[model samples]
Target: MKSPLAAIPGAAILTLFLALVLALGSGFARAHEGHSHGDEAPAAPVATAPRGASSSSALELVAVARNGALTVFIDRHDTNEPVTDAVVRAEMPDGAATAEAMPDGSYRLDAHWSERPGEHEVLFEVARGGESEIFPVTLTVEAGAAPGPAGGFAAWSAGLAVAHDFRRHIAEADPLPLLIGGSGFVLGIAATLLMRGRGRGPALAVLVTATVLLAGNAALGAETPTPPGAFLAAAPAPSQDLARRMADGSVFVPKPTQRVLTVRTLVTASDMLGRTSELPGRIIADPNGSGVVQSSVGGRLSPPPSGLFPRLGSRVEKGEVLAYVTPPVQAVDMSDMRQRQGELDQQIAIVERRVERFRKLAPGGAVSLVQLDEAQAELKGLTDRRTALDNIRLQPEALTAPVSGVIAEANAVAGQMASPGVQVFQIVDPARLWVEALSFNARVGTRDATARLADGQVLRLRYMGAGLADRSQAVPIQFAVENPPSELRTGQFVTVLATTEASQQGLALPRTSVVRGSNGQSIVYEHTAPEQFQPRQVQVEPLDAARVLVVFGIGPGKRVVTQGAELLNQIR
Candidate 1:
């Protein structure tokens, strides 16, 4: 048996196609016979509502008309924070309508008039505290249609269905109805031939030509021709509703959002940045300004007459008695002292009686007068020895401050036995502090230096001397802090920034400005535009205690984010 397509000759197929085209054209011409070309436009998408925007130097306002009402979102001109507690009034054609504040920091106006399609002007009067702004907005509300499906095929079907509706409406200046019907008929016939084992190659050509004609007709009926200068002036870019990460791997933050995030930028300058090598250092007391109070002999620790030991950070003057160490006597030493005291007391009593007898004899002229004088001298010597023995038991060693400064360390406690040469208190003049930094390479002629604390506090430094002895395979460099601030403690850790002979040219930025990207690369955010921030991968080197040098990936004279950069990276 022959194929079904073979029954129909090629000439018959050509004649049928021509008849179909003629019939479609005649139907379009007859339907639009009496109609004018100036008919109204088709209704707009039903899912979309009209929205208008107005901005001033102090505020930005967006008004959306939805479900016969207008919702207004008022934000600061600089910051995106929703404005609240502002007396807002909108002037309508009938009268002024005051907007009611909503809980989401927006205002709403009952605008049933917005449902009808028309061009209207609304004047917004906003007053907040001492600031007031007038935003005149022009809004155009258009008739909308229900939203269509989300696929290309679904859109084509929807276009065909709308074309079918136009068959009864116009079908005249609009060729969409004939294009839809002719394309569908050609596709159906081609599909029937393929299912009946016809030629696949010919069927494909037919489908392609029909699809091309369909698209061309749609474009010709819908799109209008434009002049060469039509694109000279471009439309303004729409404001971004939210901060997001762009597909190019850059963060897009609006200017208002940038202000809300408190983002700050610094201009990059190309200069000779001092090459620095980070070294672990610590805060130490100046040698000439610090002193240690220690005991000379082993004795028990005792408080001063003021009855309290000097506390840590206690201010003390030179020769101020911080504490007293009472010498503890052994059993044998106590026995020897008691024996000396008794003998001295007995000798003094005997000499006193002899002196009195001598004086009496001298007055009576029975003995020589020189013997009486000798006896009186012997009594005086015995009495002096007796007094010296009593003093040895009561005297204690006094521990006094050797320098006028604050006590940085205290170890003395009441009744505790303190060994000789043991430091009881450390008195350091806080006005002068020193920093000892260790460097692997010895810096001989280095002078300019700085020390940064962990809390970002910087201190000026003057070059002292570097130690000749190698400690931990590194040389120690000391720096005297110029104009040291209060609350500097000894042995506190600090980062020393010493300028070496080497120099580099780059932009210096705070350490906080750099952040680690998801790819584990060192990235710095550049404020590329007023409302856009782009992450720049950079090769960063240590510049100083608080700043780092960005050598590559970014050029000078660019505005780089110096503050709130990390927060900006967290968006999206």
Candidate 2:
């Protein structure tokens, strides 16, 4: 009999081996599932179906020859913009031919060479104004395939069923769950071995583990169907209603629901123009319109004549006294004032007595009129000095508003002593706000700049100025808000869209419409058929504040989902 420790290693090895096998099998199933059942079918002969061309650069050329004439499509690699008014010269198998430009940015040439049924390489050179590109394309022309009998529908249906079955099996065969369950079973087996001497416990545990593994494997197998009917039942059927593929490769949403979700469409058209840039920005107070109120001298703070402190969000006129800064008087100053008051009072009394004597003597000719006048003036001056000394300890300085606007910041507290030059309040005129954006490119001029707030609100921008000095390798561009709403706050971060004089034409769609593809490429779902949406990779550029310009991948008149794209991307 094997020792318990020996059994433990065996159980662990068994579990690991089983997990590895399941994982390998799962990978194979996934690979098989992604392939179409009819992949082995021969390619169909060329026909007059609607043709399209895509390129990875400025030189993708697709030419179709029909009835002794050839039609060509030319597009730029990045933006998929059509190259119009280009002089196209193609070297055919027999001779060279010059193509004429069509209104739709395509070219056409009369087929002067003999019609042949073979693969031929055609060299094409396209020139427009100052730019030119060369494209080499191979065209294979063969006899059209004959139509099959109507009864062949069953075979097509069978092939679709098989493909779906493969997909279902692939989804079910994910091995992580199986590996976990297998680990649990092996642990149970080890426990059983450890308790070998216990009555019936080891046998019971072994039986239970075997039963669990068999059941679990059976469940995993049952998840995928081998027959056509089983596959149909397992897979979700494509709904008659229009559906779009989400970012995560999931499906099943209706068009009416999409419209309710604010789904908008864009028709792609491309042209060569200037490139745009998006920069991070923030909402700031206009320097000319915002001001901070600070105390000029240190003293205790008190409310103005209104007896109420100006609270935050309160509007105040320029130069309005918002608070009172009462200059604090020390005990020594108070004592000095009191002493001066007593001295002035005594002086006044002595002068008053002298003045009284002088007035009596002036009438008796004992004193001259000048002496009486002098004595009276001294008594009046002494009385005035006493009154002035008393009032100095009672007055306080008033703190006034520096600007005419709303109080955005208030740090004032009642009876709090404030230091000299300490900012007590910040005033901002909300009606005249500004946005500061950091631009990596030096902006020659701003044409149609706008700012997008975090809450999705967009503010119109008027160009103020661009700084020459570089900050963090970016220039600061200032834009004054044209119409600011109440929700806008100072120092709030925002996204600024600054338009340059250069122009480019492309399919402009809402920024939310594009999603990241599995391969990490930018992709948008094209409503290809009535009920199916195919993912198309696109090259995107900044268009404006709310939208992105699709330069490639789709064409004009195609439908796309704008809103609920993220939700669609979440579908598995």
Candidate 3:
């Protein structure tokens, strides 16, 4: 049972492999010029919009065309401020037209030439405050560049064109046609299967199935009605003027909307700034300017002569009576006082009788002068003790403010029993507030400091002192607010930035410039163009109350968006 392939000999097998190699090489050498073989240069960035940018010594202008209309945005060259009161004239090859002022500070013109897709030169003349400047802008519109995916007729047409080119190459190419190369490759595979002498039928069947699928796809591509050449000449439809995020993660904001958002930029410059550390802090009352009113002994509380307790936020002066605490006497103490008073009365009566007897006896030479003096002294001492006990039951202790400030806390209630050393009211001076911060590093410098509120309000602070005691693994540092705002309250949270003597060189940007990105990285928006903002991830450190030091990911002399960066990041 000799097989047919075994009889063909080894020379024939080697010849078949040589044919397969030649067929593959020739097929690649004659590949279509449109298809790349991994040696083509990278394509340029696709034009999303037809726009022209021009700048002068005093002004910067951008003109964008959409739907046969041109919108011109003019800004100051130095400050980036929008120019609203400028007379704009547009000169094109077709005709010259005056651009009408829009409510959004942009100029609009009816440009019929913009409908044609090609490069066009437009001259923009801007006049304001008796000065005029002419700027030439070259606008290029890409031909047949669609924004999204192609489907239906366009996709089918693309497939058909590829099939057509393939068929033409197989018919007319010189060295070896792709059809011949594929047939040779199949034959080589069949020969290898025959030499193995097993499962030949199934291998042939699988190859037959792959061939059928290729043929069916080619037939379907030929049946499509769209012509092969129409795909390259298609034009993109007009889109709306809106802010959107580009594919590269940059945001495209129209100039008119930038004004509404109040976008502002700062030109970054590298300089040495004081290094700062952000500490968790809270607002506290100044110790020297604050006080607490407390009862010295257990007693009942009573209102002052004005008849009302000083309420919270009520301003009080130093030594002003806030409340009264009357010490209630127990029954036993009262009984003891009565007993003592009776004893004192009996003693005084006896002493007075003795003193009168001494005076009479002295006149009869029966008593010395020293005896009369001693009896009078004993009578006087007993009367004084009796009077002091009466006054103790009548008088009440008056509670006065220790310092001039507003009553920040109040616990005074008339007839309420108060304990000894209980704080009745707390007073704080709003103008003399202090921020207490906890610094993890014991060596945190206090050369300068500031406090930033939750609402982005910054307060200048003067270094007071730091405690030597460790609390929660951190030292407590105190800073007195200079010219504190009236809205500040005790216990409000604040971020305290304590500046050290060490200096670091970096670009300083406002705290508002940085925003949290989608991936939780800190990013800043750079005003790379008039309306285009690019997000640059940056490494920053605390610089001061209102600014941060950008140490990396951005260089100096770049215009970064200082205001509305958070709003810019919202565009997606």
Candidate 4:
């Protein structure tokens, strides 16, 4: 009762399987890279939210439409500061509506016309700071276009279903895969029947299973319209207007994101500004308010009467004794001193005996009164010299502070040998710091100068003087800090911007506003639209510590981002 397929060789079945696999692979390869076989093209990039922008000489206005509502943003044209209390009224084709000010510094209007898909002219009348202005903007609304796709598991599953359908369509369009699959299916069924021999029940079950599988695949591959109720309800999702970089190298930031980033802007304006030069400098102690403790002669360092040398950062007043320097006497010098002492002693003893003899003889008229007086004076002089020599050997030099300040440096140690003219301690007044900068130019202005620290802190400086001599091919200029902070330390590096007598006309912008572009050019972000920022390459020059002069590339009346520009550049 064995069927004819039961006698077929196993090698023949394997050969058919390999042929089927090769055919399907070749079909997939062609579909993947050769051409498109599906009806739907790949989805286009998601568009930004609909918006309109308009600006005038004094104010800038922008409107964004979302959820059947239109939100308007207004700011000052000069400073780019948000205008919170402005009254905004919009006149549209259907009707007129007044906008309510929101806490987020935006005006919201309930515009029923925004839901309709068409171009609408909007006249916005804004009044703030006792001034009123009218701005006209054209807004376009697309019909049946979702702001963005839904989120969560529903969206993910929907995306997977779409991909599956697209793959099925490609398989259907290519006939090679279908032909191979059908031939493989027939061969597999015939082999199963041949192996079953006389078992009719099992053979019938296999036929039914194979038929069901083939029908299921056919159903999945076919195109069918889905009912609206088939899908779960669209859940509440966050807005899709996110901050991203555009293809044109611009950045698109939504209003909400801007608020979170605390982005601020400034309207650039050109004016005649004084020229300035930047110089490398460092903080130094003021000459009049700083002091150095040193030994005039080689000596041993000892603590003051308080029994301790001043530690670093110790505060001391002027004339406060800090330490004592005991000069070491060499053996030869000691011997010489002893010899001088002995000689003085002998002289004093001899002079005393002579003076006594003269005094005693004066009364008998054998010696004159003037001679006795002179002999006594010689004895007094020898005694004074002997006493002074002994005092000099025992005395120690007391070192005191010359100015009131904190000890910035300390090299003193008890019983430590100190060389002459060697600095033992350095005292600096924290409140009286000076910045020394190397300036190549001679005619630097003495009126305005500033020092910028690494942490972006700026200190006002008063010009002291510039050295006539050249140092490192530059003149050394000294400037006294007007009000230095306590955290300032001597030897800390800084950038000194000193004003010059020359003047130039340019737009001055904050240093943070300028950033380096991908191409290595200096660029600044301009608020071109309500939620869009464009990069403008600019050439800059030194103006002051906090600002730079823009020579060109951007003109006046454009809003330039000041704060949060670095954050804006990171968008991708």
- Predicted candidate 2 versus true structure: per-residue lDDT over 276-354, tens digit per residue: 6777998889988999988887899998898899988989999999988877889998898888888888888899899
Which candidate would rank higher by lDDT, 1 or 2?
Answer: 1
Listed in order, each prediction's TM-score against the native is: 0.58, 0.53, 0.69, 0.74
Best by lDDT: 3
Question: Worst ten-residue run, lDDT, model 4?
Answer: 227-236
Task: Please state the error at residue 136 of candidate 4 in Å.
Answer: 7.8
RMSD of 4: 6.1
Better of 1 and 4 by lDDT: 4
Question: Candidate order by lDDT, highest to lowest?
Answer: 3, 4, 1, 2
Find the number of clashing residue pairs for candidate 2.
6
C-alpha lDDT values of all predictions: 0.75, 0.68, 0.81, 0.80
Compared with the true structure, what per-residue lDDT tens digits does model 3 show for residues 259-357?
888888877899988898889999999999999899998899999999999888999999999999999999999999999999989998999999999
Native-to-model Cα distance after best TM-score fit, residue 335 in candidate 3, in Å: 1.2
lDDT of 4: 0.80
Give every collision pair in model 2: 57-77, 79-551, 246-568, 246-569, 247-569, 250-571
